[model samples]
Target: MLQVEDLHKSFDDFKAVDGVHLSVEKGQLVAVIGPNGAGKTTLFNLICGQLQPESGKILFNDDEIGRLPPFEICRKGIARSFQIANIFQRLSVFRNVQVSVLSQQRLSNKLFHPAAQLAVNETNHILESVGLLDKNADVAGSLSHGDKRILEIAIALGNEPELLILDEPTAGMSPDETATTMALIQRLAEKQGLTILFCEHDMEVVFGVAQSIMVMQQGRTIVQGDPQAVRENTEVQQAYLGDE
Candidate 1:
């Protein structure tokens, strides 16, 4: 569903993303893993049109989306959650998703009706999918850190994206929260058939949930394979995983 070829991005003399290539099939949950400075986020930015690639191509569903703006790319069925939660902390959980639903429908300028009423059912469904339905009326800022992350995912789903990109979905959570979030991602891929691509530092989460893994280092893709094969890759161990 997504293809990136010969992608390169540089800042001054330093190359952040150097000749990276990747492909993700429909309904597959893939994980990108690497140490710091691996350029994982930079690759995501290029794919989502946050940063135009210095060269190479990005194709989503066979159309060249390399130069499209972020919103246009989102409209083309790509949505991403950031490393940090991005939501309206002041708004209720329901209203936070409602805002995205309105924006997706291009109803942001329509002040005639209340935003919460714009797509009530769809908003509720998104909340339910992320296990946040009961807290729909609660203030977003009052939720725990993990709940906040789930809220961000619900907001991303508000766009009804065909492909969801999650940047460090389980970043700062406790083990229980991380496990819950990983299971949620697996359910989304297996039951809902949502295409998911995520970057995670936690090896346990990456190996536990991802059907396939891509390892990057120094701005390049060094290994791409299933969990066992990637785990046994000596070069991957030497470079990042170490001999542990």
Candidate 2:
């Protein structure tokens, strides 16, 4: 559902993303893993329109979105969660998702309409999908760290994206939270048919949950394959695991 070809991005003399290529098929769960400075986040920025590629193409469902702005790219059925939670902390969890849903429907500015009544069912449905239905009435700032991450995912779902890009979805979670979040991601792919691509530093999470993996080094992909194949790759062990 997504294709990135010969992508390149640079900062002065440094190459943050150099000649990288990646693809994620429909309903696929893919992970990109590498150490710090390997350019995973830069690649995401290029894909999501936070940064334009110096060269190369980013195609979603065969449409070239390389130069589109972030909002236009979002409207083209792509949604992303940041490394940090991005939500209205002062609002109720339900309100957070409701705002997103309302914005997606272009009703965010309908001041004459009852804001609480707009997209009620849609907001509740997204909350339930991410296992946040019970906490819908709670203030977003009051949720646990792991729950906050889940809430961000719930917010991303409000866009009804065909492909979801999660940047470190389980970054700061405890073991239990990591397991639960990964399980939710897998379930979302299977049940909701959402194609997921995520960047993670956790080896266990990447190998355990991802059906396919891309191992990157110094801004380029060195290996790409199924989990078992990638796990046993000599280059990955030598370049990624054996580096230090």
Model 2, 90-196: lDDT tens per residue? 99999888888888888888724654587888899888888999999999999999999999999999898999999999989999999999999999998988899
Q: Candidate 1's residue-wise lDDT over 1-244, tens digit each?
A: 9988888999999999998878899999999998867898999999998999989989999999999999899999999999889999998999899888888988867624643367889899889988999999999999999999999999999888999999999889999999899989999889889999999866677997898899888899888889999999988889864725
lDDT (C-alpha, whole model) for all candidates: 0.90, 0.91
Q: Give lDDT for model 1.
A: 0.90
* Clash count (model 1, backbone only): 0
**Candidate that would win on lDDT:** 2
Most TM-score-accurate candidate: 2
Error in Å for residue 86 of model 1: 0.7
